[model samples]
Target: MSSRDPAPTVSADEGVPAAAGEPSSAAPVEPAPVDVPAPPEPHRSRAAARTWALPVGVGVLVAALFTLYSLAQWRAYVVKSWDLGIFTQLAQRYAALEAPVVHIKGPEYNLLGDHFHPLLVLLGPVYAAFPDAFTLLVVQNVLFGVAAAVVTWAAVPLLGRVVGALVGVAFGLSWGLQHAVDAQFHEIAFAVPLLAISLAAALRERWRTAAVAAALLVLVKEDLGLTTAVLGVVLAWRARRPALLWLTAWGVGGFLVATRVVLPLLNPDGEWAYGSRLDLVAALSDPVGLYDPAKGYTLWLLVVVTGAIALRSPFVLVAGPTLAWRFLSEESGYWAPTWHYSAVLLPVAYLAMLDGIDRARRGRVRWLRRYSRYAPVVGLTASLMLLPQLPLWQLTNPGLHFAGLRAQAARDAMAVVPDGAVVETDVGLMSYLVGRTDVYYLGNDNPVPEYLLIDRQGGGVPQEWGDVLQVAQILHPGVPFEVLHARDGYEVARPLED
Candidate 1:
């Protein structure tokens, strides 16, 4: 009764209980919404907004400086190949309205007749347009370098942007390094870009694009087609099912059409035999000494790594064919050795490596996760190991700044022959400079034109030239010759008192 009026009870649902001297309850509070800016576009650099400007600018400037320095020293580091002389001659002949043809005579000789390779044919127009071979060489260097970068960019989805950029840099730099060892415009270099495109298309599940690329690969070189076909099969298998059928139909059908129909239709003699060395095991075993394991280990490593990676991804279907070809296809004993041929399969290798690295980096594949961090490291290491052999900048300039020892040798060899007389010489440059055609074999059994102009520095000598049945010894063993030219340890000669 004493507190009945004083203690007014409040229900929990009505409101808050009051403290001794405090207000009953505070007004209900609502939090304000937080704001966040949307993410910037993918291609744009968010880092650039803050402190990236200085670093980015510095990096670009450094790169430009290196490019200029490399460009300046390009000519001094390159070596010329014998095949380049032949191709240049063909191009020059084409420019002079002469129908040019590549002639080969050997057990594995390709009988392809006048079947114009788009790349080889390009030489005609280039030679017609340029005053010197150096111009065409420069163009080729720039083209392949750009091609490597493009391929790396396009192939990155299998890995990621960062990895892809690494790949691009590796490929571009490696290509530049190797350019010094071979002819700048050799079909080998030209085929690289095409290979990259072909592999990318195959991986993208574009059967038609892959097929066209495969066909073109074959058209460029018969052996290349087989390699491409192997890669196509691997890609198709990885894609699986109905898609595989379409890819197969497209890839194989296109190859058949191009090799059996189009090429043959264009050149009656454009036929290549599946030689014994094309056997898979035989090539791997290097049964014929055409493939040297000791010398080709670096290239083989690339093949093995790529093949293993492709097996783990959908691209295995395409890579399978490539793998088979890498071990099976016969190699030309030309500018493109077995290792060089392996370079053509780099696109497949790159894709495989990318897929493997991605899986490893994502920690998705149990087998790959353990080595994830090291995958790219290994790849880059491999690239670095392979880089020096393929010099890129060297291709831009012939090391022949002035007629040096080789030129002097050539001149001396030329001096051995009579003036205004036909001579057979392996040194085509000396022949061109001396303006003599009807060049005959050194020791080849074929009829010697009037003289035998020999280059002491060339490939020992055509095997046919060494035999008594060959025209050189058979026609005139005691033919008097002068070493009219000598430069870079080369010699040009012609029979003088035959």
Candidate 2:
């Protein structure tokens, strides 16, 4: 994910401990004594270049494909939620080197209070150069792409070139990633690539790289601190890195401060709103009730996607925090394999599949070895078969990038509102205008906007508020508004006095 950081080196086999008689678990990181000796220096350089090229090429391709749909969504105005607008506004503030004040959230709301993501400040420069919501989507896809490349890098030595590249492509196109790309830009996008690099580095026994990646994850999202802690625990137990103990402490401490101090202090409510989700006492009292069918279905899909192979590696424990919080939370949205929720788990599952393959190949059980031998193909096949119904399917359509009549109408509505004016908007037209306007959600309480843009049939509009005038009156009680333009259920308005 780093411009300076080279991709994971494709040397050494990531192997498990040889049955009870094997020389220690660390025996695997070393290349098996090559009796054939080293290749000629000239040839070795070429071979190394080619070896690295394959994964790099695949990563770039995967990233392009993922970005394809992202651009399509942005171009077509296929916003799934207000999150796109929220991030766009946040990025604009950061670009101007201002506090993360997001008017889409509210006129005075600092987004750090919504979630402690100081890492997003990095987006300021990127957004400054590109200055569009699509930039966020591209950044997100490229991160996912890097993860895919890392997975391919780790898999190549384990599974060989053909199957390894297939697995990498599969990981990129996996249901979880596709769903996330389909859902659009989010802060969680950063976590996906970091998890992949950390797991891949761990697989190759690169403890330093693993530590760095895991540390970066804590900054991506507050909840991911637990994931980092769990990764450290697994690494410490797997090997004797004394530094890992400190890594564990770093993770635990980061989570505590992010939730208990940073988030609450930034939040207007003076509390991390999501802190309520961590009620261990409630979870303990009714552990059985937490076993809802939707959660089970989510678990089932995770297993099925990996063909049950991801369960073999203890590194899969990295997904524990991700799963634990989801199951612990009352939000049913978290329990399902929908949106960007499960994006972090994709890299963990695919890399763990590689780890699982190692253990399976070494196990005494013949059936297990055979299953491990084919797990990559099994996963790839499963992903390919499901691709048609996934977001990538849009890539095959003729109109994939077309901004339809409704999209044009939205662009028009947003065009009517001058840049930098305070504007209240519903979901459909909100993100399009956010790049320039001080956008507020239409129904929310805030300083009255100079303009109002509404999509009468927009996803978030209250169904009972059918009349356009009625909506404006509710937004600014005593003020009168004149409809400047209305087309295809999209409306742009201004105060009668303006």
lDDT of 1 by residue, 32-124 (tens): 444658886655455433333332333343234334433443323222444444455556656666655332111122223333244565666
- Which stretches of candidate 2 lie above 4 Å from their native place? 1-48, 398-403
Which prediction has the highest TM-score against the true structure?
2
Residue 18 of model 1 has an lDDT of: 48
> Against the true structure, candidate 2 has what lDDT?
0.84
When summed lDDT is taken over every stretch of 10 residues in candidate 2, the lowest stretch is 9-18
Candidates' RMSD to native: 12.9, 13.7
Per-residue CA lDDT of candidate 2, range 1-498, in tens? Answer: 989998885445554445676666443455665566776566777887877798888889988988877777777777789998899888999999999988777668899998978899989999999998878889888888888888999999999999889889888888899889888889988999899998898889898898899889989999898898898888887767766977778888899999999989989889998888678788879978889898897787777767788898897899999999988988888988879998999998988888899888998889989899777777777777888877788678837445554877777777788888988888887777878778898756877678877787764788687656778888778988888988888877778874
On lDDT, the leading prediction is 2
